[model samples]
Structures are given as C-alpha cells and as structure tokens.
Target chain A: MIRTFYGTDTLNSPAAFFIALTIGFFFGLTLERAGFGSSRRLAGIFYFKDMAVLKVMFTALLTAMIGLSFCIGLGVIDPSTEIYFMKTYYGAYIIAGLIFGVGFVMSGWCPGTATVGMASGKLDAVVFLAGSVLGSIFFNELFSIVKPLVTWGQSTQQNMGQEGLAFVYNSLGMSKSAFGFLFTLIAVVCFWGSEYIEQQHSDEIGKTGYFNTPFLRAFSLILMVSAGGLFVLDGSVNAEKHKAVSSSYGLHMSEKALLRDVASAVDHVEPEELADYLSNQDPAVIAVDVRPAKEFNAFHIRGAFNAELPDLPQFVQHHTDKRMIVLYSNGMTHPAQARDSLARMGFRNVYLLTNGLGGFIERCLKPVSLRKEPMPENSIRQINLWRAYFYSFDNARPSVIGSNPSADSAKFSDMPPFLPGFVDADWLAVLMEKPGLKMIDFRDQPEYNTNHISGSYAMSIENFRGVLDGVPSMLMPANVIAARLSLMGIEPVFRFSQKRR
Target chain B: MSSGNQKPYSNPYLAGVFLGVVLLASFLLLGAGLGASSGIARLGAFLSGLILPTHTFSSEYFGAWGEKPLHYYLVFMLLGVFLGGLFSAILSRRVQKSVVEKGNAISSKIRLIYALTGGILVGFASRLAGGCTSGQALTGGALLLTGSLIFLICVFAGGYAAAYFVRRQWHD
Candidate 1:
C-alpha cells in the first residue's frame, strides 16, 4: 500500500519534525554554498552581471520538475495522497513581490539566505533579520489595512481555465507527456541561454566563470538521479494500481489467497456438535436461520438470529467476525447460498450446518430412524436427552395453533409479509377469545382434532371448494357460507362503532 | 574538498542539483519543502503576544498563530537553516567575528540604515506574499504555480526599476 502523511492525524509528529530539520540543514547548506549567504552575489542578478542566482535556481527547478514528471508518469509519487499545492493569490504575490524586490536591492538579503548570512557572522545580516521580524509584526498589527490588497484576485485560480498554461495546453488536445517534453525542452533552452549570457558577462568582467563543473560529471549525475527516482517509485506503483482495481470490483480480500480460504470453508459442522455449543452457551458460536419468518417462527434452533433474505447484509454487518457464524435452514439450499455469499464477501468466520435442520432432526432426534451402525453409548444417551428437550413439542402439529409456537418462544418477529393469509399471531390470540368471532381450521379432520386454534371449528377443505370439471375450486355462494359460519356462532353483521371522549 | 583559508563558492549548477535533491528528500520524507518567512511571522506573533496577549489573540492575523507560533514545522526548519549555515561557514573558514559589509562609497551608518529598511520591507512583503524567495521562488516556482512564477518575474522587474535610484549606494 502507498503511505502518504497529509491531511491526517499522523502527518505531524516528532519524527516528521526530525525529517524537516534534516532537509532544512541540507537546504541551508546548498544556499550558502551557492553564495546566497552573501547578498552581493544575489543582488548582482539585478545588475545583469552575476547570473548565478538565476542559473542555480533554474537548474534546481528543472531537475525537480523533470524528476517529478517521471515520478508521476511511473505512478511512484501520488500527488493526491500527499502533495499540497499553495493557493495562488495573483494580486497579493504581485504586490508583495514589488515590495520584496525593493527590499532585495537595498538589504541584499531574503529571509532564508539572511539566516545563512547571519551565520557567516555578517553583522548587517543579523540587524536586517531583526528588522524583518519587526516588519512582520507591523504587518500583523495593521492587517485590516492590507487585507483588501492581498485578497484581490483570490478565488479565480481554482478554475485554472484562464490561469495555468498546462490547462491551456491540455485543452488544445496536447497530452501531458507531450507537454512535459515541451516543458523540458524549454528549460534546456533557457539553461543554454543563461550559460551563453553568463559567458559573455564573464569575458567582459575579465573574471572566472560561475560554473566550472566537467560536462560528464553533471550529465552522469542527472541520469543517475532520474534512474534512482524511477526505481524507488516502481514498487508502490503496481500496488496502487491493484488497489484501484480491487476496490472497483468490491473485493477487499487479497484475491490471490481467497481461493485457498474458500476451499477450506466448505467443511461443515454436525447438528449434534452445534446443539452442544448452544447448550453450553459457547460465545464463539453464531446461528443464523435464513428461512421465512413464518417458517422460522414455527420451528428453529434456539439462539438463532432471524433475517429476511434482503436484510442479510445489514444483519451480518451488525453481528459479524466476533464469532463463528453457523447458518442453517429447513434445508441446505438457502443456507448454503447465504454462507457462500457471505464468505465470498471476505467473511472468514461464516460456516454452514451440514444437511440443515431437517437432517439434524433425522440424525439426532428421530428415535426410530437411529442407524444400526455402532455408536457411542453416551452419545446415544445425550441424543435422546436433547431429543426430549428439542422435539418434545410437535411444531408441525401446531397443537395450540394460534398460540405462541415452540419456535415463537424463540426470538423472532411474529408477522411474516409473505404469509399475508395468516393474521398476526398476537392479534389472532386476542381475537380468539372475543365473543362474536369464530376461528376456523380448514384442514383435514384428523389434523384439526389432534391440534387446532382454541375454540376454532374443525372443517375440511371441501366446504370452501366444489368440483368444477373434476378440479377443486371456490364456487360456494356467499349466503350459504355466511349461514354455515352463523351456525357456528359467528355473526355475519359488520360492527361499526365510535368511541366518545 | 578545498580545506583552505578561503574558497570560492561551489559551481552554481552543481550547488543547484544538491538543492533539488534536498528539496525532493523534503517532499518524500516530510511532505513539505524549505521555507523561512512564515517562521519570522510566527516569531512576530509569539513576541507580540508576550507584550499584548489579548490584542494579539483578538486580531485576525496574529491570532491565528499567536497561541502556539513555534509549533509550526517551518520554525524548526528555520532553526536548521541558522545551524547549517554556521556549520558550513566554520568548516570553510568563512565565519568572521564581526564584519560590517558595505560599499566603499557608503558610510557604515548609512549602510546599516539601508539594511534595516530593506529587511523591514522584505519581511512585511514576505508575509503579505505568504512566502519569501526560498519559499515562493524555489518551492512554489518548481511546482509551476502561476502566481509564484509571476511573483518571481515581478520581483526582478521591481528590483531593476528600483536599482537605478539606489545605484549610488552600491557604487565604489
């Protein structure tokens, strides 16, 4: 990953301060070595004689510019990650430059070089430095007077349409590479021009020239710097590109290692083992029942979190990673899909229950279906014990139908939107005890007699259907059905009453 | 490696390459470049606050940096500038005890007065400009900032225009 410290809490620290000091040391050394410590050399630029200031400054500018261009091209330095560009204040820079220029000729020192000059034991540099500090205080003291002048043409540079030459060149259909090449060309030409002018000036003055470095040394150094810049930036370049692509595809997992993880996650846990975890209240376990609310309310394992299909993402987000998520359903299909989907999304903790809850009931609870193969005597005893606890209530029978089912005793919402035919269990429980209403069970006679809603009339499916070309259909007259319901103490009258305050 | 009584300054181009490497190191390691004017402004704020804390704290300009002026990275860099220059001067035998530099034509008192005036102008202008020569010219100029480039050109123009008037001060 690319590391950049800017616009973040980590940007400032003791370490950053140390780095700044080191760089400043080198900067100061370079300035002093280039004769910036002496104001005479700097001021000679104005006299059109010593072009060292311009020459040295331009060389540094071009080197950095070319180096940065290469860094950007190779994707080593991400400007967006770390670089901060100073806002342009056109009017302020112009006004400030005018003032600074006059000061430059008079004092022969700028702020940074003056410090270096002062170090050289130049008494004038120290005095001038103190005066500059005083001037800074004066500016701040009368800021309200200067604010208007400095703030003029402040916000226009942001658009860059009428400002930066790069924008103009780009808008004219020239690519960045082409522009960079042209820019480098211009810099080289300027470098040559400065050298020619300085040579003429040197001849006129009958003095030694400013630069005396051998051609090969300078040329080789430039090549070596360029190569070093490229080499350093290359490692993070590919990493950044991979990051962009991975994020675009919505995969945060290391794609290279994901297949191995997925291969191992296919291993499933037995229902008996899972029940032991639930009984022991193992905190590492998470049970997710992905079946419809009605089905889940009818019967589901204890401690399972219920969620609709569409609510899976939000549900998982709320309870993820802290434990081993065990997903199961009435069958394996939906649970398997949910587990695989979660795992594909970089969730490593999700697992599937083998054969689902149906297989669990068959293998561990059904007494008659016990396998003939040799089994542990203690395991059999434990299975029978759990069977009594889990399967004692006949969830399929719905013994107290409208009352809370055994799974309803487990945590789950009562109302399932897909089961629009059934009234809410809470509402139906209240209405079952009402005087005028009669609850009906339109199932087989044996099914109703064994277990039904309290005080509900037992009836067959045929009462609500008739033979139409040998196909069962709803053809009963409304009055006939009303009379049948009235005979069972159900009123046909509609109740409409208003309550008074 | 001329360890002698005095040596001429290094080749300007070679010195500049060294400067660029240092600047690049700054960008890579500190996410910043060399600067000076802000340090002086921050010093001003620190000093003014000592005299009139409430006034410095209330005013918009000084108030921004008045509370913790020296906390800035640039202040440390400026300190380094002082130290590094001293170290280089000592090694090169260029450090003098107390030498007043002035043209043969100008009196020491007059030269001192000119230096003070010029320093004041540059100091105030650098703050208004948001950076000095090293900050704006080298750092921002290399970044190809339009305002900085224009400022660099204008500084030269302004200096040339003013030099005609001050020519007598420098004439020997």
Candidate 2:
C-alpha cells in the first residue's frame, strides 16, 4: 500500500537532512528566543526555579500524540505507515539516554544546545562540541568489539523496527484509544508533578526571566514551521477523514438537545415558535425532559416526562410510536443539538422546543395566570414553521453530511464560503504576493498534506500550540498572538477569520 | 563569568519541541535522525587517519573508523547544525565570547575539567548505546521507543545521583 507523505517516507535521506538542518536552525533560534542557550537558565530545571521546559514539552508531546491518535482512530492514516525507532539495541539506548540525561542536567547543555552555545560564543560549548566529536570517533573505533554485546541475544528479526507506542500497546493487548488516554493521564500527572516541584523550590530558582527571550521565540517559530510541514502533509492525506469524524462526533453529541450557552441557542431557532408549541400541545403530547437528571430534578417544564440525556436513545428505541416526542431544554439550542444526535441513531420526529422551557413559561404558562401584554403574532408563526420544517426532515437520515468515508474524498468544504478567514485560497494567494504574510494552516498532519489552502504552510495545531507556549483562548491578547505570528513571518495587521470558532 | 549569575535559559518544553522538529526533519530529508556523536566520530577518524594512518588502520577501534570517508552525511549535518546555531545567535545578538561555569563554586579550571570529563563520559556512553541523548531520549522518547524511555529515566536518575557529589561545581 502507498502510504501518505507525512510518515516515514517523508523522512528519506537528503530530504531528512535538509529538514533537520532547517528545523535545527529554527529550533536553535527558538531556543535562543526562549533563553535556552544560558546554562544558568537551564539549571533552573534542577533548582525548581522554572518549569517552562516541563510544561512545554509535555503539552507538545501530548497534543501531537492526541492528534495522531485521533487521526488513527478516525482511520485517516494507517498506524503502521511510519517506522518508529524501536529496533536498535535497547540496552545501549537506555544506558546512553541515562548518561545523556545526567550530562544534560549537570552541564546544562546537550549535544544540540552545546552547539548553539558555541554559536553564542560560549567557549565551554565549543569545548563540549569538540568532546562530542572525539567521543563519536571513539565509539566508532570500539564498535566492532561492542557489536556482539550491543546485539546481545535479541532476535535479529526484531531489528526490523516498530512504529510509535501503538505496537507496544497492542503487544500488551490494550486498545490504541485506551493507551492514548493512559498516556495523556500520565502526562497530566507529570505536568502537575513538575509544577509541584517548581513550587517547592521556588526560592532557590528565583524569578527566571526566560519567557520572553528572542532565543525562545525563534525556537518556537522553528517548531511552528516543522509542525506546519507535518500539518500540510497530514491534512492533505486525511482532511476528509477528519471532517467526517468531527461531523459524526458533532451529530452524536447533538442528540442530547442540551445547549451549554446562548450562542448555540441562537444558531437554531427564534423564541416565538416555542411559545406556539406550548399553546398548541395536546394533553396527550408527551413533553420529555432530556436534560441531565440533576437538571430535570432541579427545575423543568410542568407536565414533562423526565428522560435523561443518555437514556434518550434507549427511550426512543423502546417507545417507537409516541404521539409527539417534544424534547425541551433550558434554551432553543439544546433541542436543535439533540435533534441531530438522535437522528444519527435512527430517531425521527425529534423536535426542538423553540424558545426552550424559558420561552414556554414566558409565552404560554404566564398568559393563564395574569393579564399578559400583547405580543407580535408573525414571529410566532415563523418559529412554528422553522420547527415544522426541521421535524419533517428529522427522519431523512442522509448518511450524515460532512463525514469523509473514502481515502479519495474530495474536500467539498474547501469551497468559497467555507474558507477560513485568513486561510482561503484567495487570501493565501494575496498573502503570497505580499512581502511576508506567511499564512500558516494550524490543522493536523493529514489535512495539511492532502490539500492546504494554496500557499499556506502546514503546521499541526499541536506543534504551533506547543511552541507558542499553549493554545490561545478565543479572547487571548492580540499582541501576544501578533508576536507569535511575527515569528512566522506573518504580519501583525493581517485580519484572521473568527469563523472556525 | 558565573554561569549561575547569567541570565536564565529559554523554556525547555519549547526547546524540546523545536529539537523534536529538527530531528523529525532530519529523519524526513536525510533518512536519519540527529546524532552529535557520529559527527564527532567522523572528525576523529579523519584526524587520526591523517596523523598516523598505519596505526589508526591497524587498531581495532580507530581502524574501522578510518575506513570510511571523513566528509560523510553526519559530518555535513553537524556542520549545518553549527551554522544554524551561529546564524540564530548572530541574528539574536547573543554572540559574546565567554567561559560558562557555575557561580562562585568551583574555579574556572575545575569547571572546564569537569565539562571535559562529563563530555567524554557522555560521549562514551552514547557509543555504548546506539545514539546520544538527543537521538535516544528526546527523539526516541517522543516516538515512544521503550529503550528510549528507559534511557530517559536512567539519565534523570544518574544526573540526580551525581548532582549531590558535584554540588561544589555548581552550588555557591
């Protein structure tokens, strides 16, 4: 089978070397930007003065691993497409890694950093580099003698090598998803542990002002580019698969008819239609409350059957022909959300109570008790018509739109209206024409590789987030975002689309 | 100048990611991951071959190294690494000549000696194993290589163990 470009095939010889050099340069730049070249700064890890290293590394790894696993779970890329570095002399690598780690902590410089140190005019770094070269030569000379011991009694066939943690996980009979979950849990624990350690030794490490350095910034940019490369490669290969999974997941969650906030509510229906349902419903029309049990118990519409969210599927399955399954939530959003989810599982006639329970109370229940003010009637009719139209098509299960089922699935969503604000083909073309707009697509590996908006560089969102400190919240400070963008050659003034949100 | 008194370093997490990407790219373009020792080894082999060709070729260890050309892929990669590092340092205006040793602890001479010794030990250990710390620990660890994990754990353990004895070298 012809595997995609983002995997091992992408790392072939000259390409790999060039990639390494380019990435290395950027990595060095980011390291400097992050203040990595200074030994005292690095020693902060040991003294517990700072824990940026721990936070950034674990987050990056977790993000990438999670994204990778999601892609695998969605079957966008075959898990076995790349060769993981596992077949070598295990004993040798372990011993080497341990020694290297010790050297790292003590000297505050690894092989990579020592060179960067040399570049920054640190004589010690230069000396260290010299030592490394000599060390490598010594190893080469001694290789013949150590070859037998290196191989030991390990099977020769095992030398064929494995790829990623999945092989180890599969060998242990655990599912990839389970392993991914476990790894994430462990990483979170490690993150917490690092923080605790830093807190414990806060005084000794002092306030290390390393966060805003040029070295670190440059280092982050390099990572961003590398991630971009991966994203472009991976996105192109599995864009459709990702779209499919996201849509499917969206649909499944939608069935609960629960809206977390008002924004989601506004996306579906107006308030007046829900008022109409309250006035028109017959006594026999079973109004099922499909929110959480706690929510139902706290306060729900009067005369509503308490059916919890998870139980809705089972309830729908058991009660095939109920008079009218009118699902209501706190707002108009939940009902619309729930309708999609229920429809995916073969449920039909799922209706969102327009205006939700709030609307019903204001429009229908209030009129019976007190003299009510006159309300506009046209808005009520529009709401009813909207609800009726959706309910009619509820049974039409059209194979769940936006779910990519084939390897060769064309990205129909890549069309004009669906283009991301900063990353449309036209926007990219314009940016490319500019001196230095540097459009970066922060998607996953497969999606970017398959077909990114033309001229936009692919960088996995995980990598970008990793190097950028963390994922930027929707309302993050613009300056911080701009600073990050500047590192990637993107202008601070470029308007980014908020549509993806 | 006192290393401890010097400005602190960049965030390691970010650095690690940067390092990972470089390694990834090396794998993609060069069909090999990053290795510091190999570059050093090639240089050593070449130097030894030129200085004492007969002895270098005859020796069990050094002899095998001299068989290969000096300017191999690893040598070029290492050269690029130095250039890249230099470029970044120059651009950032961080280039300044200085000796980096811990503050007011061990004298400069001792620090240099220790650095040399540490380098040699790390170098030997890297050879004993198939790759160096970067290759095995960061790169391999990210890839979830079992040996790499073991190596990373051991490095921490070893460093901590040695740290206590070497406190004089760093602690004020």
Candidate 3:
C-alpha cells in the first residue's frame, strides 16, 4: 500500500463499483454453482449427509491462505493495508456466534448464502434478509442495551504482523518457516480427509468432485509447495520495505495565493452568507467574535465562537483543517487587524466581516419605519425573523458599558516608541516553518526546554547584553558579535557593495 | 417445466477452486475479501432509511457509512450476486417459485414456518456476529484470525447440537 487506509480508500471511490459488480458477479455465480443457493444442501452439513459445505469452505479458505502467503512473500500483499480485521471482541463474538449458529441450523442459511437463495428465487431467503435488516434496526434502536454488551470484550489481540497462521506459530515460539511447513502439512491432511468423507457420499450426489486429474493434482501440489517455500524463503505477509513518513504539518501556501485569499476574505463577508452559516451551524465555517471576553459574554451572535487577539493564534492553530474562520467585532479595526495577523502566518481562510453589527442591523433587519422607502418582500420577512429572536419590542435595549480608560488594552497604546514592527505569536509560528527564517528564543535554555513552540532555537538575552566598565547594560561590539557568530557557524552581517546598494 | 438437457452443477472441487480464485483475486485487486453480509446489512439500513431517516442516518452504528446507506461496494456486489444467481438459475432451469421445501417426515406448512423463523434468527444473529458464513467463516478463516476460527467452530457446534434435537424437520 502507498500509505495507510490507501487500500480501502481506493475501493471506496466511485469507479470501484464496477469492479465490485464484476467481482460480485463471479462470487455469486460460484456460490450458486457450488450448491450453496439451496438450504437443503446447506443444512445437510448438520446431518452429515452432505459434506459439501465443509469441503467447499475448507477448500476456499486453504486456497486463499496459500495464495495470500505467496503474495505476501513476493511483496504483492500487505495484510494491514488491504484486509480488515475487527478487535478481539471476545464477548460479543462468542455470544453472537452461538446465536448465529443456532439461527444458521434452524434457517439453514447464513446471511451470504441466503442472499444467493433470494437471487435464485427462494422466498424464504427474502424473509430472512428482511428479518435480518429489521434485526439490525432493532439493535440500533436499542443501542443503549447493546453498547455495553459489545464493548465488554474490548481487548487487543493483534498478532505480530497480523499474518494468517504465522501469528499463532509465532505466539507458540515457533519460527514462521516451521509454521509454514506445518501449515502445509495440516492443509494436506484436511484436504485428504474432506476428500475421503465426500467420496463416501459421492454415489448419492451427481458429482464425484474429483476435478483434480493427475496433472491438475500434480500442478496443485507444486503450487502448494511453492506457496509454502515462498513463505519460508522470503518472509511472512508483511511488507519488506515498510516506510512511513511523519509529516511536519505546516501549511505551505504560496505568497500570491495567500495574499489573494486573505485579502478577499478580509475586505468583506456578505451579511446573508454569515447569517446562513451561523443559522445552519455549518461545521466548516467558524465565526470568531474579536470583541473582548466581557463584551462577548454580555451579548454576541448566537453561534459565533469568541476569542480575543492575544489568544487567536492558539485557537486558529487548534482548529486548522482547511476551515474558513470568519472574524467580526464592534467595528472593522479589530477583525481587520486579526485577519492580517493570520494572513502573515500563511492562513488563507481567515476572513473579516465587511461591516459590524450596526451594518448588519441596518442592511439585514432595518425596520419599515427606519427604511427610506419601500422594501423587498424577502427583506421584510428577514426583518420579521430577526425581530422575533433579537428584538423584544417591549423591552429590547442595548447594554451600555462606558469605556474604562485605564483598561488593560491601554498597555499596548502606552508601549515604548522604539518597538514598531511587532510580530504576534500567530505570525511568528508561520515564520518558524519557512526555510530561511529563524526564531531566536530570547529566554534561558531551561525555559526554552520546558515547552517552547516547535522550530524555535534558544538564545539567552544575557549573552547579547553585558555591563560595560561600570555602566548599565550595553550591547556587544560588532567584532565580538562577528566572532561569536563565526564560532556558531552562522554568517555575520555583511555590508552591501556601495554601487549595488 | 423440467429441462431434460439441462447442464448439471459444476463439480464441487472445481467450483471450490473457482471460488478460491475469486477470493484470492479480491484480496490482490481490492485489498478486501469476498463478503455478502455487510452488503445485506447496508440494504437493511437503507430499508430503515425510509421509516426513520434521521435516526437511520445519525445512529452511531449505521451512520458511519454516511447518508447514503446503499453506497457501499458490498451492496453492489450483493446486487451482482442476485443477477449472477438469477442468470445461473435461469440457465439451469432451477427458478421454479415454491413456498415449501421439506422432506417426507415433515409437512410443507411446518417447514415453511421453521424456514421463516430460522431466517429471522440467522438475520439477527449475523449482525451480532459482525459477519455471517462468507465473511467470518470463509474470509476470516482464510486470514486465519483466531476469533473467526473460534466463531466458525462455535457455529458448527451450535448447528450440530441444534440439528440433533430437530432431526424430524429434515428426516425422510
């Protein structure tokens, strides 16, 4: 398999249906042709009068076994990639198997064979199939009861490499080669035994089942020997060159594309689309109210997810799966600033609402009295709907909180004048993934080691500054900086050629 | 309506070989084994879709396959089985529609009732078993899964024991 789940994903696609139909056509034909379409023939196994079921099942199982073992050795089969296995499920399986077995003997049909019977015009099969479906529905409807029952036997029984017989032999401290040899011997014994039993009943049935002429038998013998030899000679059914690549999942959007997407989203979001997304609770679209926590809790859009600018990076990083994040605030500034920060981080799906709540109310739910003139029918209906949820005609009033001048937000305004090009955590995270960019952590090594963001290199602030000759903190000389960088194998700053500059 | 010149069914060994080849080809080509149970289960869910569409689509068990219940490959295969079986039965003249198939010791009425009862039980049990004869017994057996083999033995043991008690149902 190219990667995990690749096998099933290939089968689950649209074109695989034709292959499924073709495979099914042959599968159905083979089942029906083998006398499996009739319950009397099937039920005969219980009576020991007809050994067809055992012969058929055992033969098929062994055949696939040999074929798969060979394929695995030849690197053509990867068991985990293709074949599916459920958990050990000991409790559920045993009980279910007992009940299914009872049903199998009584009905004389299992689910698969019953389908074949129905196809061959057996009315009983139809009833069985219908009843099975109803039974499934009943199980689902009363899931509360069945959930606990099924989960009781949850245990990991994964065999080493999940190889067929190799697992059992490996568990028993036997080499896979010996297991293969023993496996071949067992299959031969079973084959011979089934033949002996079937031959006893050959006279009653029309067919002798001895399709293996001398040459065919010899050929099959060779095939079996080769299958066994391959398992021993090469290995079990696991991939030889098993390689899994761990991804450093950083979005690698091109600058042009990033600018185009973020620029478009940041400029405007239509009122109707935002309303529709929020109303339907569309999973792909997340609404972020960029307002403060206090304002968000007081009143906000019904389904909008809230986050301030400081916490937006972690929130966005946590939620990144090609989702569109819509940001809105009281006015345009907050959302516009947040969207820009996200855009620098190569996130293309972050959008700023074109207008704030005031614009939304004016455009989406303007009262007829407030309207300059006549309004459209749809607008009138939308206004009425908005009125129902948001407008309590008798008591509707906006909560007013006078601005607190000394609030925490004033800290940003009063910051030192020298720090102009401030990059937030969101932008820095994106820069970390870039090939040529470097993030020098201005913290102690222990602080960096504790839990720094991935891809940040530690560099102490103490190393960059020193007390120079009884003076307070002073920067290192250019020559000292050059020598320090040279020791670390980093290129020192170079002056541009005057003409080129 | 008996066709005197109708071809007999293939030899069991020959048919078994063909079945094995088909099973092997499925593993190689599709990374899956031959199965009919899940197809039927999905069909069951599809039927339930008409009655309880929301519950049918949202229920954790059935909903995993998403909105369309009949979209799985097994369902298509089941249809193919139906078509193939119909074609084979038509070619062999085995398509006579009758309500009963019982032996001399048992009346057709009693056998029919038993058949319906048995059918319901098997249907319900197959879901619980996570598979039926083809899926668990044949496919899992081929894979040599411990659980599948155990289930196989239990099914046979349960069937054999049950058959002893109901010998009259098939005795002729």
Best by TM-score: 3
What's the TM for model 2? Answer: 0.50
Model 1, A1-501: lDDT tens digits are: 234445333445666667677777888888888888887677777776677887678778767755665655554665544565566667888989999999988888888889999999888898889889999999988787887666555533322212222222233355444444555555555555666676776635556553433662465356445544544455455565566446535554454444433433343666866877876678888788888888787777767778866777778787775577788888777876776677667675677787798877777676632342223356578877776666545453222333555433422233332323454466565555656556788754434443567788976556656765676465777786777777787766432222111
Q: Which whole-number lDDT from 0 to 100 does residue B164 have in model 2?
A: 62
Give the interface RMSD values of the models in order: 10.6, 6.9, 5.9
Clashes of 1: 0
**Model 1: residues >4 Å from true position, as ranges?**
A1-12, A155-179, A203-206, A210-501, B1-4
Rank by lDDT (best first) = 1, 3, 2
lDDT of 3 by residue, A263-294 (tens): 22434576656766766667898888888888
For each candidate, give its TM-score against the true structure: 0.57, 0.50, 0.58
Better model by lDDT: candidate 2 vs candidate 3: 3
Docking quality tier of candidate 3? acceptable
Q: What TM-scores does chain A show, candidate by candidate in order?
A: 0.42, 0.37, 0.43
DockQ for candidate 1, please give it.
0.27
Location of the lowest summed lDDT over 10 successive residues in candidate 1 chain A: A159-168
